[model samples]
Target: MKAWQLTGFGLDHLVLNDIPKPEPGPDEVLVRVSAVSLNYRDKLLCDGKYNPHLELPITQVADAVGEVVALGTGVTRFRPGDRVVTNYCTRWIDGQPTSKETLYSLGNTLPGALAEFLALTEDALAAAPAYLTDEEAAALPCAALTAWYALVEKGQLHAGQTVLIQGTGGVSLFGLQIAAALGATVIVTSSSDEKLARVKALGATHTINYSRTPNWENEALALTGKQGVDHILEVVGGKNLAQSIEALKPGGQISIIGILDGFDSTIALFSLIKKQAVLRGISVGPRRALEDMLRKFDELKLRPFIDSVYAFNDARAAYDRLEKGAFGKIVIRVRD
Candidate 1:
């Protein structure tokens, strides 16, 4: 078997090598990976930015769509040939997360998905939405589920509400679609006018080019008739969170899901206090939320937008695309 391994701290060190594929063990399933999606985290890991101390020479990437080619004894939930999507959190099946559940995540502590074959505990897989292609399903584990968890599970987003989505990346695009399908008005912000126009066609009620209009939060406020948005998906961290605070309605919520801008932020506590705003830090989500999100997406016929696809051997190109910032999910097609 061939696996892309992060042998050292940088992309230069991410080399492909022949390795013995594992047969499934008790309660495990052997997956023949069809496709794997690139996330910003993949870039971070490759550059040694995610965790400087992360062990070397491991498979990289946490999201994949695959088929169960074989199952170990005691695996009762799935049979051979079932299409499956990998779970971001291997342990958190439902509800609140504890250290036990959160500690056992992929692309960090556990093995990753950037291989032709992977052995996973049956609990770490979910039924792929039958309507989606493998490449599309590959984006769901982290990108799609983060949006679903932040909006549906934590923010309690509902129809008739307004959501402010920052950027046109995978999570933001998923946020726009989910908010739109739920009948919520969505305002999307991007640095590029071209990207903003694309979001408008994808159901964004209003668009803001943050590069053109530095005070985009004020535009969001005006778009909502000064009432402000009911919810915000705050993917850009650092100083940008202040703008998000300014864009929120009183008693509204902001779900912080990324640190693209930087990790540190100096915020005015009084702003949140005065607005009675709720800020929630969101990890991807639990497996139950993944199941619920897939069911909803299936019913609504939601399809993930793929920005680009690279062949299996060209996996590094997919990471390059992720680093350059793609409009939607970048996928690596594992099967020729």
Candidate 2:
């Protein structure tokens, strides 16, 4: 089977090569990967920025959609032809995250989805939504699930609540759609007016072109008549935290999910104190959360926004596009 391996710990270490196809163990299933999606974490892994360094010669990318080709003994949840998507966090099968569950993530501590065939525990796989193509399904496990956990599980987003998403990246876009599906009014922010306009058409009721209007927190406050939004999906870590803090109403929540803009930030202590705001950090999510998200996708017929698809052989090129900050999810087709 053809797979892309990280020969060492840097971007220059990645190389494509042929390796023996994997066989499933007694409790595992062998899946023929159909498509793999790129996330910001993939870029960090390539750049050697992820903590708990990945092992060399390992495949990259945690999120993928595949077809089960062989099921090992005791694997009863899946069959040979079932279309499946594996959870990024393989160990968190149920309940809150534990040290054990956090230790065995796919593509980090174990083998990943960037290969033609991957062997996984049956517990790590979920049936793909019937409405999604392989490329679209591939995009869900990380970014989509993060959004669902941030807004649905943590925020408890209700209909008619207002949501503010910091950027138009994969997770933020998923946040927009999910919030919209739940009947929340979504406000999107982007440095580019063009991108903001595009997101508006996708159900954002309002957009703040952060480049043109630098004080976007004021704009958000004005848009809500000084009450501010009910929730915020914050991606920019250091530079935008103060503004995000000011853009929330009393008791509103902000899910600090990414550090696209650097890790440190200056915050207004008074705003947090006065608003009684909740700021929570989110990892991808658990297997049960993935299941709930798939159910919602199926119920709403939600289609992931795919920016582009590259062939498996061009996996590095896909990473290049993600590093350039392309809109939506970038995918690699592993099979036809």
Candidate 3:
């Protein structure tokens, strides 16, 4: 078996090496990976920005779509040849996240899915949406689930409501589609006009170029006729949070999902108090949510927008593409 290992704390230090093939335990399954999707967390893990103390030479991605080539004893939920998608938080099977669940995150504490073959506990896999390709299914574990958790599970997004999504990345795009599917109006923000136009075609009712209009929150306010949007997907952390609050309607919710703009920030407390806003920090989600999301994808015919694809041997290049920022998900084909 071949695996891309993070031998050290940098992309340049990653090595592709022959490794022993793994077999499942009594309650596990052996998966032949078809495709793996890159996330911003992959870059952080590679650059040692995620956890400087993380053990060396670990497999590098948490999200993948694969087929069950073999099953272990006691596994009854699936059979050989069943298509499955990896789970981001292996231990958070249902309900809310716990401290224990956070400790077992893939690509962090547990082994990840950057190899041609992976052995996972049957509980850590979900049946793939039959309508999606491997790459699209692979793209769901992290970004897509995060969006669903934020918009559907936590935010309680309703039809006729308005949602403000920041950037055109995987999570934002998923938020756009999910919000639209629920009949909510979507306002997407991006630095590029071309990207904004593209999102508009995908059901974004309005688009804002944050680079062109620094006070984009005011534009959001105006777009809602000064009532402000009903919900916000706050992916950018730090100082940008102030503007997100400014764009929210009274009693509106803000699902904080990313820290792309750096980790620290000083926010105006009075603004949130005045708006009576709700701020929730969201992790990817539980397996149950992933299952619900897959069912919804199938029912709504939702397809993930893939920005690019790379071959198996070119895995490092996939990481580079993620670092440079892609409009949507970047995937690596692990097998033909």
Tens digits of per-residue lDDT for model 2 on 230-322?
A: 999999898788889899999999999999789898898988999999999888788999999999899999999999999988887888788
Overall lDDT per candidate, in order of appearance? 0.91, 0.90, 0.91
lDDT of 3 at 14: 82
Judging by lDDT against the true structure, name the best candidate: 3
Question: Which rank order by TM-score, best down to worst?
Answer: 3, 1, 2
Ranked by lDDT, the better of candidates 2 and 3 is 3
Span of ten consecutive residues with least summed lDDT in model 2: 96-105
Query: In candidate 1, what are the lDDT values of residues 1-336, reduced to their tens digit?
Result: 988889998788988888899899999999999999988888888788877888877888899999999999899989999999988889889979775764576777777888989999999999999999998999888999999999999989999999999999999999999999999999999999999889999899999999989999999999999999999999999999998999999999999998988998878899989999999899889999999999999999999999999999998888888878899999999896
Ten residues in sequence with the least summed lDDT for candidate 3:
96-105
Off by over 4 Å in 1: 99-102
What is candidate 3's local distance difference test score? 0.91
Report RMSD (Å) for each prediction in the order shown: 1.0, 1.2, 0.9
In angstroms, the error of model 3 at 83 is 0.6
